[model samples]
Target: MDKYTKIIEQIKALEADMVDFKIVDFYGRLRHVTIPTTNITDKKLQFGFGFDGSNFGFAETGKSDFVARPVIKDFVELDPCLEDPTATFMCDVYEAAQDVKPYESDPRGILRKACNYMQSLGVADMATWGPELEFYLFNDLLVRTDPQAMSAEIISDEGYWGSQDDDYSFATRLPKKGGYHSVPPNDTQYQTRVEAVRRLTSLGYDVKYHHHEVGGPGQCEVEFNLMDSMVAADCIILGKYIIRNTAQEFGSYASFLPKPIFGEAGNGLHVHFLMKGKNGELVFHDPNGYMGLSKMALSFLAGILTHAPAITAITNPSTNSYKRLVRGYEAPCNCCYGMANRNAAVRIPAYATQPEEKRFEYRVGDATFNPYLALASILMAGLDGVKKSLDPEGKFGPLEKMDKGWEPPVSIPASLKEALEALQKDHQFLLDGGVFTKGMLEKFISDKMQDHLRIERTPHPVEFEMYELI
Candidate 1:
């Protein structure tokens, strides 16, 4: 039987009462509808279920009608905590009239187009990506933003900064930035991480590892298995969902905010990627070459470095993201690459010893990005570099040594304004295959600029403390 037919049958056999047809929106939010399991048939999957797109920040109120076509390959079982047994499936948005797939405007459609573009260029049939999911687990989170008052507070029982006050436990606490690899009891959230990993693995995602991060307060990271860019993006969305839900089960909250706390390590979504041929051979591996990187691979790295600043507008969209990219915090602020250098925008991980295992990690992105747009944009930039043979002169340094004299010809943008400006000027590379259209680009820029203005007009709570004494 076909995949959808089998899935429907399995849902029935499992006594599932509801099925959730879900999709990740442009802002990385999960949008879905829970319908009776009886309604999930092969024909229904083919025709799609209708929804209001306006609420999703996608359409005008008058023309908000849209359809969601199930991507059966991206299906996964729902968590058992819900009242009814349910299965969730990722979907693609389609226009109501002709039932045609939406273009760049639809986040999922953009990912599809990027995949097609890759095929068109004969670059690679698939690009695999593995994103290291880092987040903060807090005991309590409170926030208020108003014209009269603005403040935010977070509490963590295991936080290094707050642990000293815990008279209940006399256990010695690690100093600031010393939380990495701390053992059980001191780690505090070890069981939480284990549960999160277990849940993710049960949902068919391969669990690489889970551990406490450098952030003292319940900061942790869970690494998922690598898959094609599209599938990987879907996993990222689902992974975030599972992490948050699991945290709630433990009476805690998990946040993917780039910088959730001051004077602490920031969370990052470090993405490792590999381009391979259909034969399952590593196309980017050249052991005899520098850093075991092939010509195509070097060109791809060059393209990414050249477009790194512009890509940030989408990859690190939020204003708060800039706070994490500051120097001395292990954030990648420079447009450069090196072997095993976490501070570089791109780093070739030394962990991969086999030929097929070789890949490069782009360290600049955070979890705030829409995975579909971010991955597609990065691929488009790389493809453009290959097509034009764009050489990233002096951008990549030796793997073993630090090149103090080396400076990137193009500097990465330090602020959202500069990043947006870079996007405005350097987005032609993203337009070659129409993976990212002019209209969508314009809308994205306009929307982000509006967000920038909103934050700029509002005075920060810290500003009051600084000026109140004056």
Candidate 2:
């Protein structure tokens, strides 16, 4: 009769032995709980199973109890990854109190609230996002972090390293930065990517295309069609899951690390977004506007550029993220926008000529981001820009005109600490509509600061190579 009852009935039809409940943790990793299907009832589906929130880094030990309530809409009767017939559902975390409430820091919940907030305003009833998920597929990956030995070895059958070994080498080993859209033989991960995309298609995703990326070491990309904000974020989370699982099945490893290989194009989760007005009109397109972007679109672009450093504190929170953001890798190093300019933080895609297709891409993010937080932060900042009518024309760019000696007003933060510090000073926008609370921001900053310090104190393998002679 009810949605949960309907979901239970559907699961029963599948005759699944177990129900797999999956949730995204603070760091964007998937955490799961399994229960026999016999125990699944409507009440269980409604109330959800309990878990320790502190273990997810969401609360202290004293206040760690939380509920992982499954979303009825996310129920999947057949999962392609699992060999067994197990029903799977994605979950949203909530407080396990007498008066149950949505967890404020829950990444998914935060994005949901942001979407609702956007709709509450008269400007837009819905926001759609198209995200490009890029990652590396490795044939072999090894890492040692011991005090006596610290090193990482990444072996890609399609890379030049494969050429050194006659036994393992393929005839078409890819040279550094040479794998973009490469065909078979050179693109050794082709079947793996195709299989991953097939699984995604089975899971109801509209994949645009997938191909080898510029990093000849097996870097690949999978682009998905535009969907609602929350759905887009969920797609990224589960997309990575299916990809990683599928890679393992093929005896390979899929890594979303921003800069897994030095001197190569890095992985980026470039997002393109456009809002729909109350009348269902595209809010970002204008034929008379600069490069066919409406005033509201420019304002949105300004918001992202203005708050990019702060947003990067969440989107590119890892230390290795900076390694990819540096110059010469096409990663944005400046807070600016340009028509089809890959070097700017935001770029209006050259091919998006139609009203529905017109949208600006945020180029400064990576797969290391928690999709929910990363996307929500960008939306909040853009909404704030809309509220203020922030114009980026003179301040940020149409950088193509820089042949006359133009200088950027802002530079992207060069380190994680700098980005976090920017977040500390410029986070009032994130607090709009109660999407993000001060406490949540504080926790995120403190936790990331600890991570940065830990990495700083550790000795890197490159350190030995550089300082051993001294």
Q: Rate the local accuracy (lDDT) of all candidates.
A: 0.81, 0.89
Instruction: Please report, as a residue range, the 10-residue window in candidate 1 with the lowest summed lDDT.
Output: 163-172
| Candidate 1: tens digits of C-alpha lDDT, residues 1-470 | 88778878878877887988887776889877888987677888777888888888777789878888877763447754465678777889877776365634788788889889988998888898988999988877888987798877787777655532454533535567877878877787787778878877777777788888888777898886678887788878888888888788888899999999889899999899899887876888998856787778888888888888899998998888888999888999888888888888989887777888878999999999999999998888888877877665454554345465666666668877788889999899888778888887887888788888888888988888899989
Give TM per candidate: 0.94, 0.97
Predicted candidate 2 versus true structure: per-residue lDDT over 1-470, tens digit per residue: 88888888888888888999999998888899999989999899988989998889889999899999988784554677998888988899999899998998999999999999988877688988888999999987898989889878887778777633455656667878998999988888899999999988887888999999998889899998888888899899999999999999999999999998888889999988888887779888899998888999899889889998899998898998999999898899999889999999999888988887888889999888899999999999999999999998988888886655676777889999999999999999999889999999999999999989989999888887899999
Compared to the true structure, candidate 2 yields what TM-score?
Answer: 0.97
- Evaluated against the true structure, the overall lDDT of model 1 is 0.81
Q: How close is candidate 1 to the true structure, as a TM-score?
A: 0.94
Regions more than 4 Å wrong, model 1: 1-5, 74-76, 80-83, 163-173, 398-405
| Residue 281 Cα positional deviation in candidate 1, in Å, after optimal superposition | 2.0
The lDDT of model 2 is 0.89
